[model samples]
Structures are given as C-alpha cells and as structure tokens.
Target: MTLLAESPVAVGPPAAPPADRMTRRHKLILTLLLGTQFMLTVDFSILNVALPALGADLGFAKENLQWVATAFALPAAGFTLLFGRFGDLLGRRRLFLTGMTLLAAASLLGGLAQSQEVIIAARVLQGLATAMATPAALSLLTTSFPEGPLRSRALGLNGALLSGGFTAGALFGGVLTDVLTWRWAFLLNLPIALLVLVLAPAVIRESRTPDKVRLDVPGAVTVTAGLLALTYGFTAAGTYGWGDPSALVPLLASAVLLTAFYLIERRAAAPLAPVRILNRPSVKWGNLGGFLAFGMETAVIFMMTLYLQDVLHYSALATGLAFAVPGVAAVVAGLGASRIIGRFGSQATLVGGLVVQAAANVGLLFLGTDRHWFIVVLAVLGIGFYGNVTAIVGFNVTATSGLPDEEQGLATGLTTLTQQIGFTLGIPLLSSIVAAGAAGYGSTTAPALALLGGIRLGVAVDIAVTVLGLVLIAVFLRRAARKNAV
Candidate 1:
C-alpha cells in the first residue's frame, strides 16, 4: 500500500499511526523530513564556490584542497548504504537522530577549524553524520507519503532540491564568504540543523520493522572499506602519481574486498547488495551515465568558479550569478519533467537532455576567452545544461513503488550512494585531468585556454558517451514497449 493511502489502520507497535486519513500534522512531519534533506543537500553543494576562500583561510595549497571536499565525500560515500541497510534492520528514527547529532557537532568543529588537517577531519565527521541521516531521511519520506499524486508531488519537490541546492549554494557561498567569512559556510548549518532538530521529534513519528532481521556487519565493513579505499586511490592518484604504490595499493585492496563483498551478498540472508536491482540493464546503464554526468557537472561548477574567481577575477557574487543558467534550468526541468516524460517516454527525454548538454559543451569549447571572465563564456556553457537526476528521480519513485515497502529503504539508499560516490570520485578525477592538461600548455594564454579546452573536450566526451547510453535506453525501452504491446 502506498504511504499516502488515507485509510486508518490501527496504529502499530513499531510507531506512527496507520494512514486511513490525512491530517495537517502529517503534512507538518513530511515538511520536517524534507527540510532535513534540503539542508544536507545544500551543505553538500555549497562548498564548491567557497573552496578558494576556504584555502585562503586555512592555508591549504591548491593541490591539497581537494582533500577538503574529498574528506566529506569519502566517508559519506562509504557509510551511506551500509548504514541504510542497518536502518532497515534496526530502526530509522534512532539512526536519523543520532546522525543529526554527530553531523551538527562536526559542523561546529569545522567552523572553528584552524588547519588543513582539522578541516579535513571535521569534514569526515560531517560525512559520517550525513551518512547516517540521509538514508533515514529518504526512507522516512518514502514510508510517510502515501503513494499516488501526493507522493508524486512531494517527490517532485524533493527532486527540485537535488539541483535547487546548487543555485542556493553558489549564491549563499559567495555571500557568506564575501561578507562574513568562508568558515560561515560550515557554520551556516548550525541554525538550519537547529531548526529541524527542534521540530523532528515532535512532527516526525518513530518507525521500525515489525520483524527482526540479522545485521550484516561483515558485508557492511568490507563494502565500506572497499569504497573508501577506492576513493582514496582515485584521489591520491592525482597527487602521488597514478602509479604510486600508496595510491595503487589501497585501490587494489578495494577491488578485492568489493569482489568478496559481492560474493558474500549473493549468499547472505537480507543481502546488502539487493541482487535483483543489480541485474537490471536499466539500473546499470542509468547508474553509469549518472556517474559520468555528475562528475562532469561537479567539474563544471568547481573549475568554472575557479576560472571565474582565480583566473577571471570575478567576485563571489558575480561568480554565483554566472551559474544562474543551471540552477534555473534545473528548476524548470524538475517542474516540467513529468509532462515531458509523459509526452516523450523516458528514453526520448534522456536523449533530448544529452543532446542539449552536448551542444552546451561544444559551445563552451568554441567560445573560449583569453581572460578568466565568465561573461563571454556564459552562453556557451549553457549548452552542457542537462542532468539525469530529474529523470532518475521519477524512475526511482515509479520503479520502487512496485518494490515491497521494506525494500524501499535500500532502494533509496542505493540511488543516493550512486550519486554521492560519483560526485566524490568524479570531482578529483576531472579536476586532475584538467590540471594535468593545463600543465602541458606552459604559457599564460595556453594554460587558461588549456583548462577550458580540456573541459570542452570533457563535455564533448560526455555528450558522446551519453548518446551511447541513450542507445541502451532506446533498445531497452523499445523492448519494454513491445512486450507491453504483446
């Protein structure tokens, strides 16, 4: 039964009343959960523009600053799924609040951090907090909202948040950094978290599974370690050289451990991997394309902000203004996506977005400027202005509805993990690629132009690869259509 079905079943032993009817109180709870998610996402995206300012305050070098971002991503990536499954087994509400506490503390510490190590450490703590809180937040939302129009409406708003955050982050980061201080970026969470924390217990109901399930500690550890090691490997490769033993060693171990994890999941009861989802070509291809798109998107904003501030010499606010296209585009896309999907089918929409994005990338390539200023390149950059998130968000809501309610916890967890891991790993990889290429240019115009050139090519490659992924979508969707016709 969808969470939105408004028939009153008696309230159960676990918590939260059975939904037979709607109440204003119920909507209030949903709002609190959504607020939690928005805060986490905003915190996640806000730091991109603020990174340069952060380095100035903390004295971290250009090369090492990736760690600041990596610190949050690595642990968050590692822990999300593992903790998510735990929430499935244990209790979502308990994990949710616990994570909130830890995340809040880390944010406080991060705001006060004086050195690179301290900031990095705080970031990892922040990651851990989000790791616990994020899945719980999703599971709560999915469980609370009754399926159908209400759920769809709620999910659409949530989808807006996934990209809406970028706009808020860019604008807010520049504002906070310019006026108050870069540390305020981290500190800003305090009030928002404080607001939600106060409201959660009162508004949100407690929830847990009725039956007992064994916790998969071994599976969780190995997978978490594997992801952490892999991320560490990719991140260190940029600095210590790709061939460095320190970098290569952990990555190899990550591979072995993950392989073992798959084997374990195959046999284990209540498997952590959820084998059925892995078998779908739609899910697999979607995840691959999503990763590439996310990585490229991060690079778009991260390096662009650098090009704007460090190279082009734009202020934080101007830099934020420069990105108005993506934020606005994303919001429009989110609102209209259902109708678009209805008209075109998922496959067509996916292809359309990629084609548009590819054009944006190519435009950026040809529109290069000798100066760092973004004014000239804004129109060009608009070409690569597409994302898989809106499509995927809808897919998730629809597909997972067919799934049993108990399974939705990890369903939400898995999608979140794919995007986070992609962002965590993609940023360093793309940035490093651009940096390496820039080094080859060796002249003033050559270096800046090289950076733009590399990104342009990166977007071109994204376009090609995305269109190729679209091929899979076309094949699969047609096959589905034929089967449905039969």
Candidate 2:
C-alpha cells in the first residue's frame, strides 16, 4: 500500500525525490495565516462606523468613547516587538495558537459586554492577542515558503488580504450596525478565529531558532514603554491639543525610554533586537514607506466616510455599498502585485504605487455636492486603493527579503508596528487639519458647506503627505535596491 515500499529505491542512500515547490498543503497553510491577518485588520476599522451606536447604547461620555479604539491600539503597538521576540524564543506555532485562543475569548467578551469599560477592557485583551499572533503568523509564513520569489508572492497575497480587510470593514461596519447591532462587529471574529485555531495545528509545522536563547527583559520593558508612550502622546495630541502636558510629557518620556531601549540592546548578552538588523536600509526605509502608506490611506477613508454621511446624506447601507467597488479593487491589486513587482522591480513598483495614490487624492479635491459624484469618487479612490495595496506588498517584501530565518519575526513585527502607529496617528493628525480648516471657514459658509471645505482641505493635506512619502520611497528604496543587487 505504501509508495516507498513499492518503489525500487532503498531507504538509506537513494531516496524518493522531494517536492521543491509549494504544494496544495503549503497553499492551505498560507490561506490560514492570511485569513488570520485579515480578521485582525477587519476588526481595526469596523469600529469607526459603529462608534455612535456603541456610545449611545453604553452611555459613554464623548471623550471616553475614544477608549474603545485606543485600548486596542496602544497594547497592540506597544507589545508587538516583545511578542515577536517571544515567537523566536518559544515556538512560533505555540504562541500563535495561544494568541488565537485569547483573541476568541476577548471577542466573545466584547460582543456580550454591556458597559463601555468592559468592552474597552476586552479590546485591550484583543490588542494583546493581536500583538502575539500577527508576528508569529508572519514568521511562520516566511519560514514555510522558500525565500525570494516564492516568499515575495506569498507576501503579495498577504498584503492584498490585509488591505481588503480594512475596506471590507468600512463597508460591512455600516451594514452590520444598520441590520443588526454594533456587537456583531466583535462577534463576527469568533467563528473566524475558531476556524483558524482548528485548522492551524494540523497544517502548520512548528519552527524556532535551533540555538538556545533567553528573553531580554530589559529590552522588552523599555521598548514596550517607549512605544506605548509615543502612541499615547500622538493620539492624545489629536484630541487634547499638542501643547498640553499630558501629550508633551509622554512624548518626552518616549524619547528617554526609546534611547534606553537602544542602549540596552547594545549591551544585552543576547539582544532582543539585533542592531545589525536595524541598521539594514531595507528595514528602516521600508517601514517609513509602510507608515506613510497606511497613515494617509486610513485618514482618507475616515474623511471620505464623514463627507459621504454628513454632506451627501447617505444612509449607512448606501455608504457601505458606495465603498464596495473600491474594496474589491484593493483585493485585486493585492492578488496581482507579485506579477507587477516581478515585471517592474520592487523599487519602481513602490514609486508607481505612491504616484497613483497621490493622483487619487488630487481627484478627491474636485468632489461635488450631488449624489452623481459618488461614482466618480469611488472609481478614482479605488485606483488609489490599488496603489496602496501594491505599495503594502512591496514594503513587506522589501523589509523581509534580506533577513535570516531567526529575524523574520523581528522584521514582521516592526512592519506591523509601523502600520498600527500609522492608524493611530492618522486619525488625530488629519482630524486636526480638518478642524483647522473648519475654524478658518468661520461663519461665512453654512455648516454643511463649512464641513465640506474642511474635508477638502484635509484631502489636500493628504495629497501633500502622499507626495512626501513618494520622495521617501524614491530616495531610500532605490538605495536599498542597489545595495541588494550588489
């Protein structure tokens, strides 16, 4: 019955030929990993549209309502590096399974929560779970697939699903809130998480660094503290004004803690993050590109959502439908990115994608008052979404393409950290710009028209930021490309 026993080849010297490429089983594993990432990203944006309903139901004060999002963002951003290192020290598969279990529990708690505090706490748990799971998933993905083109293609598809999650969340958030309740947003994760848990153990083989290693507690503490401080400061600056000590103090402390982290890493017996890895141009510049790509894109989505609802008077369902086309386009972009990058090269592909995003933001400048504009806006915005998705794939591939097996988790963690910080910062920074525009518009225009003006101003700022990001990609990625070619 056994093929080996039936064959002429002996068990010792001559052996059966092994498969060199990814098989169906490998593909299934990739699907499971990508699906986990998709679920996490969807949760990130789903809350935006449901905030009002949630606040009213939970009787949350206006200021406290932000905690629902902040709770998730802070720990997710802070603990990612720590968990990523843990994945390398412990078994990545074990950490991944644990994270999913915790995430499922947190989702259930949040879904059933009656008070804002309880939901916020659940979100904090969700953040911690995400922090553990994402880097491990990414690490496993890199190790499972062969490096170079195979890994690049896998990263491309991963990028696509991740981008699709955000777009889908924006669309579905409204639909769910309208049809059912805000709680469904949290509850939806339960089935998906459970499925990943059941399938992961069977499909994913365990991996770790062959050499024994210990966790670097000092590095972990300082880095986590620094990131937390930085995230909190940026988020608070958006809400409470940048001049407030509440914002300024954390920023100052972040500088100190971050510097201490670097010093600790330099002196540690086995460093948490190796300095040589950080020194890589691809890792540094790639993350900057990722930060810009995510930050501007999320800000655009937020502003557009407000414009559609407040100015155009669209229903929640209509808004979701309006975003449907662009969301699909984003997914397509992700799926096709590998082929595009292969033809064009990662550096060229990155620049081209940023250009597309900038041009789309320019298109938003001409937004009209009537419903007829929705078709034009969505189409143009879809083009931008396409560009962002491509850029995301490029950045991911660029960042991890050069790393050794052991540092894969570190590379992936840093990438996700930039993305989370981008999401956290974009809302406040762009919102401040919109607020400034509103103040400048004064009483000359009607309230709706004034809001429109502010939104336009915000889009213009986004255009400028997109251009700046393009410059960064041009300068840094090009250098990295040349270095890698040598």
Best by lDDT: 2
- lDDT, candidate 1, 63-84, per-residue tens: 8877887888888888877777
Best by TM-score: 2
Whole-model Cα lDDT of every candidate shown, in order: 0.66, 0.78
**RMSD over all Cα atoms, model 1:** 4.3
Over 4 Å off, model 1: 1-26, 285-293, 342-351, 370-389, 398-401, 404-407, 442-446
**How would you encode candidate 2's per-residue C-alpha lDDT over 292-402 as one tens digit per residue?**
778888788878877888788787767766777768878899888888888987767767877887887787888878988788778877998999889888888777676
Name the runs in model 2 displaced over 4 angstroms: 1-21, 403-409, 439-447, 479-486
Worst 10 residues of 2 by lDDT: 1-10
Clashes of each: 11, 0
